[model samples]
Target: MLIGSLLDEINKKIQELMGKYVILDAYYIRLAVYKAMNLQGTRKDSSITFMVDDVFYVLQKCIRRGISSLNTDCICTVINHANNILLTEYTEALKKNLSASNWTAVSQHLLQGELNNVSGRVQSENAQKKYITHLNDVESSTSCIIILHNESSEILQKMYLSDPPKRLKVLSCLEAFLQTAKFFDSLLSETLLKTCSTIFYKLVDNMLQGLLDLRYVISDEELLMTEVNDPFMHAFCDGLKQVMQPFKKYMTDTNYAKLCRILMPYIARSYEKVVMQMKFNYNGALRLDKDVQYLLSFLTNLTGISVRNKFYRVLQITCLLTFEKAEEAKEFLLIESDTERWPFTNKEAREILTLRTDYSEEIEQLL
Candidate 1:
């Protein structure tokens, strides 16, 4: 019993000492990261930077030493700290640099000639390049994170020579970094969407003004205009497509697809609003359908997403404009009884039905 007690005390002392050592090692590693980050602020010279190299150096050093020493707790401590740093401090740093570029507003201004002076245009141009560089940095960061995770796991297998289960336990101790990589990757995608959206919607606001002019077309002109000669109408969809085209060369397929899906609903809603306001005669209603179909086809090819449902509301409004009688429009809304509901309410239906130039006051009241 005395020997057992002695062994117990020795084991406990050993653990306490290892704990102190491991904690101190992780602290120094974190300090190294902070020092490196401070030394390398907002570098645009490369996709990867000194800060990334420094962080991975310490991380690999920490994990390799822990595995060689068979110190499980040491690896866990280092990985947890690394994960925390990447998600919070590292993410904040990237976001700060990206925001400073003013990539969103600058895109619109650059295209619109809103940057007047030579110096102002040059500065804005530099800022735009910086934003693109920051995005590259994010992509490179995610790649580095993944490569580190894989290499760390390989080091575990080679050094520890453990069975699958034991290796899995150690790998789980490092999984936080994997999750951090995914998070950084997602941040890259989200940032692209935001920048692209800022440019896209700005173009829409400018171009839609010209497009809304169709609402004022005299009835005779509407039937004669051949589906609205307006490039601005095409600019509505094609402009967004144009905005995203440059980024396709930079983004991963998954990132680009997500950007398309998220932004598609906004386009649908905007087109629906514009279509609802225009006064269409019987023939102009035909032109409206033609225009909608062309835009729909263009959007489908551009986004590589199923967009028909997104424009279903616009189609519904087009149908409302085509009806020969308001009573017919009302019947169309009620025909299904309860199986499928139209997106708009009855009052909204009446409002759309009234936009048809041929619908008399009595016909409008019938809706």
Candidate 2:
């Protein structure tokens, strides 16, 4: 009774919001569906299924008509609802003694089987095999959306992609990626870790490189320049950072080492470009606090590197930049602790870090 009432309330709220404008932002629609599904979870299957079907039906209609007022929230709610409802059902079936892997496989088959075409069948099969496949797909879709998203004002982009559109389709794909990653990470298998590593490296590589491309894509525009600035860059960076957590959680040292290897070159090239642009002459030393913090955290979280050595190396370089103009030294300082600590002589790093007026004795000791 309560579930029924809650679903009614949620539906009413969605209608009210939709009534405000000729079309609403896609996020609001999605938010409504999420709320409705949360309420439906309190009920029995028949009722929940009815709600799911209603949402799917409405969203699919909106998609065909190009009524984007339906937005990402609606699609997100639908996708999440499907996964949650199925997982709950799967768990119940397991309690009745269904083999866990069999439950997973069967559930996958059912979801994929419902699709009418070969491509959808293939995608679902791939998606089900290891959730990472879904993640990669979403990463690709998000990349595509980021390109179009920068074309106009952020508001217009939100409107363009909201509800039953190509953009929302991609956003929902991303949300599915997040949900599926969480689900599989709980299973904790070696194969799963390996698959996740591959996915993370590829996804991060593409997203980072793609964001770089986006800067040039809109290089001609003045208003669009802000789109490629810190906020946008950090969003993609955070996406990769979050995805890496599960891999770090399961495998620890080796996974972290691998991630650093995968990320280092990209990071090096990227930071090098930014660092080189900063003037090293006079008092123009670049402060790499934010970027260094992100890189170091990702490293330390993934590896068991000794903290003492890490910060000492950092302090050493910061001191060096105080006197001499060494861009290379600054670049090394920016590297994560897990990165193969380069072969900078302790003597050199110390000389740089010493920042002393009369370090002639210290310099002579190194020689």
Candidate 3:
């Protein structure tokens, strides 16, 4: 009974410290837990024999209350500090047999709390209020989005550069950033689009190296002939598609068209390689076909009418090549070679065919 009373008193002290400096208090409490468990030296063991759960219970309560009472700037500061703790301290401590679930609970509680606070602030500021209030709200929302983008970019960079990489964490962080961007776009509209566009551009630039690695794999004829499922390639492409998904709504047609053009050549080159591999390996070709199809579907949705129609024409040619029926391939070649009878104008056909050397060569062979 006396020990229980002491623990309760200690809990009250920790809460007071947390209320004073929430972010720093989290680190301090974690250190205190380590000391209380007598895990200062080589006395490390496999089990957590201390009352770490009770400590976390207290910490969770403190984090919740602190988040509720803080303003936007304070909340952002706390979030940034919490993320640092998760990435550095939590990771190291977890290896020492600390409670991972509890740490995750605390970290997630902080992140979700931050999300809720920012969301509520956005909604409240954007509510049908006075003109001066709305303007102020827009400014505040813009600042919050910028802060979240920076945090998310740090997470993405870590995930991208880590040895063997943490794909799930990278994706989760990306989704979180997208949610923030989506919210800003909905509330602030064009005022934030330029900033959002720059964020996406940087995202794609960071992922470009990974995309190039995948391209190198696809360009390898021998590997494509042997491997049935290129999981790495699929994962990378899917990730790129996911990152680009949120931008579709906010992007101007001109901007979208530019992005489509930039991406089309990569798709075309990959398709060319896949089609060449299909000549010798039917089963492996089937798997790659799905990759190409997925990319095409994504492009079709994002592209303008001119580009979409060109993709449809290319899809028609791809279908013909897949079957490898000599007669149908010859018919397609003959029809497309005729300027008047071709579905696209001669210039458009050339533009499409130039996207893939294999397509042009195959048509030339049929002619």
Candidate number achieving the greatest TM-score relative to the actual structure:
1
Model 3: runs farther than 4 Å from truth?
Answer: 1-196, 205-228, 241-288, 295-317, 320-327, 333-362, 365-367
Better by lDDT, candidate 3 or 2: 3
lDDT of 2: 0.41
Cα lDDT tens digits, model 1, 1-367, are 9999999999898788778877887778678777866654444444444666666677667666666656676666767777787777778877887787687777777668777899877776566556766676677788778888888888877755747776777788778778888898789878867764677655655665566676533466655666547555565666666566655544545556766777777777766776666777777777777778888888788777778888888888887777766677768777733446567776777677777767647554565
Cα deviation at 242, candidate 3, in Å, is: 6.6
Consecutive 10-residue window with the lowest summed lDDT within model 3:
126-135
TM-score of the candidate numbered 1? 0.73
Instruction: Go through the candidates in order and give each one's C-alpha lDDT.
Output: 0.71, 0.41, 0.44
lDDT of 1 at 302: 79
Q: On TM-score, who's better, 1 or 3?
A: 1
TM-score quality measure for candidate 3:
0.29
Ranked by lDDT, top first? 1, 3, 2
lDDT of 1: 0.71
Estimated TM-score for each candidate: 0.73, 0.26, 0.29
Best by lDDT: 1
Which of the two, 1 or 2, has more TM-score? 1
Name the regions of candidate 1 deviating beyond 4 angstroms. Answer: 1-17, 20-24, 31-61, 64-68, 115-129, 136-198, 215-230, 235-238, 324-328, 360-365
